[model samples]
Target: MTPVPEPLPRRVTVHLVTGGPAGPRLFGARVLFGQDPADVARRLGGLSEEAPLIALDVITEIASTPGRVPTPLHVDRVVFATPEAVDAWPAVLPPHGMEPMLAELVAEEPAPAVDRPRLRRMASYGIVTDPTGRIMLSLIADGFPGAGTWHLPGGGVDPGEDVRSALRREVWEETGQQGVVGRLITVSSHHRVPLTGHEVYAVWVFSHVHVAHPGPARVLEENGSTADCAWFTPDQLGGVRLSATTRRGLEHLVGPA
Candidate 1:
């Protein structure tokens, strides 16, 4: 009788899909083992290219079950697969690494993972009133919320930066006016669907301001999105297009504009 050749050592790996936050994904895959170690590696590598964000490593299919590893006939060296190398033929093998996803996989009292919404906070627009009681509004040339429309002269407040300082810098940059930042008039927020289709919540702080008779309003930010800056009374705003954000801001700052 002729001797039979033993099959090369290779195992099927499955991400083991389960209910709950189980791993990064349902973590299941169909793997084929070839007689050649290199061919087996090639098949595993091919499976990895589709998911760019995840990390896949090769391991002996000993206990290839949901978040479980069984005893292995043999283990391969270099199991961790890199995304870029996955496309190459017979790519380098990486060492086996832990699947932290397993820890995330909850078998009891399962709760599905949820992605929470994000938030952006900024504000410091000043209601710099003249004797006429009109506030300083700057016309935006481009960018979000409003373009070719007027809004209060201020911008986003940097983290750990004084709100008053940020307001002053914004006022100076957009309208080139120096003023004393006064009491916070109101804090207002508006929610809208941004271009990314994600909900965005913006909160701003509007403050009462006092300033002397200032020089001509100059746009200090060179080639900035602000096309023009000036003081305008509510009556003058009759024809101007007000951004929804500005409308909400105005509703909170003074009265309906």
Candidate 2:
């Protein structure tokens, strides 16, 4: 059997049109590796300056074409939201301008791994709610940071995988439950030095999720990062220790629970 090559990282060039007579518009064009917004726009039959560049949403997929794209007349994703409501969208918004980031994204050379061993990871976690209003959490297995502590059911997004898909996969693997992915609630980033001997930066995307009917919580993956899983009521949460990301997500999404 032939070995499969790794899927290249994808770029979503997002332009936020906050002001104009036509009102607000959010335009996103999905571009492949080494493709810029101008190239994508030209291929789509539109102008690259349709709106102001605001964010670059990166996604990895298992497989994709070289440069297949959305039509110019109809973009891949479009939305209209007030500035305050932008966070509700599924796209990740950066804190600063996207120009510098965009430049680095299309760089030809990969960052060296031998120096200090730096890694950046993206993950999707959910604040899952059952019909009974209970929240689900999973215990981190031993040898991991915050072992014995509980956190939301999620892990790192795999290479070539989108965040939403990763969330569902991880949720099922860690908790053995099915969830309907809802709106994005928050995005957070944390940098840790010397974490398992690497300087790691993690970007966490949290969303509200609903589990219409749930079975007994259990870890379903063999030797996975999760040791156990369970649901908890808000009142029962005070005594349980939570990972920093989980605590922050819960506080932002549903208040200190």
TM-score of each: 0.51, 0.67
Q: Evaluate model 1: give its TM-score.
A: 0.51
lDDT of 2 by residue, 171-223 (tens): 99999899998876755456676635777766666777799989889888998
Task: Identify the candidate with maximal TM-score.
Answer: 2
- Runs off by more than 4 Å, candidate 2: 1-7, 10-17, 20-22, 25-104, 108-114
Most accurate candidate by lDDT: 2
Tell me the tens digit of each residue's lDDT in model 1 across 30-132. 2222122223334443543243321232232222224355322222222223334333312322234333222222222223253445453445677776655
Clashes of 1: 7
Q: What is the lDDT of candidate 1?
A: 0.53
Q: Where is the poorest 10-residue window by lDDT in model 2? A: 70-79
